[model samples]
Target: MTICKGVLNSNVLFYKKLKMEVDMRDQILEILTEQRPDVDFNSETSLVTNGILESFDIVSIVAELDDTFDIEISPKELVAENFDSLDAIEAMVERLSEEE
Candidate 1:
């Protein structure tokens, strides 16, 4: 009984974490879509390399992400790779949130 309960608890925790990640991704996607309505963020993986997102767009995204996520994106993290894809942006936000 004790072992089963422990397993159940772990499963619950895992589900919660997974749900949080999904929610965070959705929020990031919403922000990105709002910033650039013409671009399809889901399909494009090379947002920076392909010149899909310009410098001003990055600036706006950084500001919105900072305000929305309550995470301070320092100058060091302002790299092309971090903003290259939806997954990259989501990963960066998760890392920053964990640091805080």
Candidate 2:
């Protein structure tokens, strides 16, 4: 059954999983926002070599991914295709979820 908390009705047990996705996207956006302060991050492909996100930023993103989502993204998975866009990243996350 759905439970109400204040003005919200959410399944408490699933909240963390839900929030993790939200937090991941926010963290990604924040990282990009800080690193590429002048670029239009919303529409471009995020590649380290493209100067959109540097290798250092990718390392930070990896750490955040592990901490925020309990997802272990390996070095082998650090392909340019994966970080091409926000849409690609979201699709990867969905694929990972299914694999688990």
Candidate 3:
């Protein structure tokens, strides 16, 4: 019975974390859309590679994410991989939040 309870609790935590991640992604997409409404963020995975987002856009995104998430992104964390796609940005935010 104790083992079953533990498993159930773990599942609950997992789902909660998943939901949080989805919410974070949505919030990020909102910010991105507001920045560039014409661009299709959902389909554009090559934001940096394809020149969809330039250096200034990246700086703006970093500021928005920093303010929204209440976490400070270090200078070293400002890499292409961290801001390549919505998932990558979310992962970076989550990692920074964990560190804090």
Candidate 4:
């Protein structure tokens, strides 16, 4: 009975974490879509390298993300690789959120 309860608790925690990640990704996608309505963020992998998002766009996104997510994106965190894809942005946000 003790082992079963532990396994159940672990599963619940895993589900909660998975749900949080999905929610975070959805929020990030909304932010990205608001910044650029024309671009399809889901399909694009090379957001920076392909020149899909300009400098001003990045600035706006950074501000919005900071305000919405309550995460301070320092200068060092501002890199092309971090903003290159939806997954990258989601991963960055998760990392920052964990740090705080």
Candidate 5:
């Protein structure tokens, strides 16, 4: 049967789809915390050209996100203007996950 907006899903497929955002958020937090243990985990995470993260970190994060969520992050979306802060990253993840 088809479900409407905001309808709770008990099906397996629906569960996986619905949980993607929560999983992405947790994974992102885990990665950021592990990479920058000295930084304030609760505070904002600015990863773009602000320099908090280097090329390597970005590569690793992108890899992890791709593998974990099975979502392909395009180069155009990788710009500093788009994936700068944690909020921005979360937004991107949500958007990509939704598209999937």
Candidate 6:
């Protein structure tokens, strides 16, 4: 059945957006794992708080994020909360992408 921009279409769009977000999350996971294979990104949320992520690591992450998503992460956006977890990073990327 063909669904216009009605309820069913809205649900379809929602699911498509959800799948895109999940794909973005997985890409971010891959990048983080490449940076620190020993770290458990799935469960570890104190990467910045626990000093698991150093300045150099942040630089590398920023570069990778910029390259992967084609979005610029400004200096002001580089806060502990933004890089605290994979979810946070993914949200930031989605927000920035929306801005662009």
| Best by the lDDT measure | 1
Residue lDDT tens for model 3, 1-100: 9999999999999999999988998999998888878888887877887788888988898899889999998889987788778778878899998988
lDDT tens digits, residues 1-100, model 4? Answer: 9999999999999999999989989999999999999999999999998999988999999999999899999988888899999989999998999898
The clash numbers for all candidates, in the given order, read 0, 0, 0, 0, 0, 0
Candidate 5 wrong stretches, greater than 4 Å: 1-20
List, residue by residue over 22-58, the lDDT tens digit for candidate 1.
9999999999999999999999999999999998999
Q: Relative to the unseen true structure, what is the Cα RMSD of model 4?
A: 0.8
Score each candidate by Cα lDDT.
Answer: 0.94, 0.66, 0.87, 0.93, 0.72, 0.91
How do all models score by TM-score? 0.96, 0.59, 0.87, 0.96, 0.67, 0.90
Per-residue lDDT of model 6, residues 1-100, tens digit only: 5645487889989999999988999999999999989899999887898999887898899999999999999999988899889888888999999998
User: Which regions of candidate 4 are displaced past 4 Å?
Assistant: none
Query: How good is model 6 by TM-score?
Result: 0.90
lDDT of 6: 0.91
Q: Which 10-residue window of candidate 1 scores lowest in summed lDDT?
A: 72-81
The deviation in Å at residue 69 for candidate 3 is 0.7
- The predicted structure with the larger lDDT, 2 or 5, is 5
Ranking by lDDT: 1, 4, 6, 3, 5, 2
Tens digits of per-residue lDDT, candidate 5, 34-62, equal 76676554565566676877777777777
lDDT of 2 by residue, 1-100 (tens): 2335632544654787689777767766676566557766568875544767667777776676566556778798787777777656666665665676
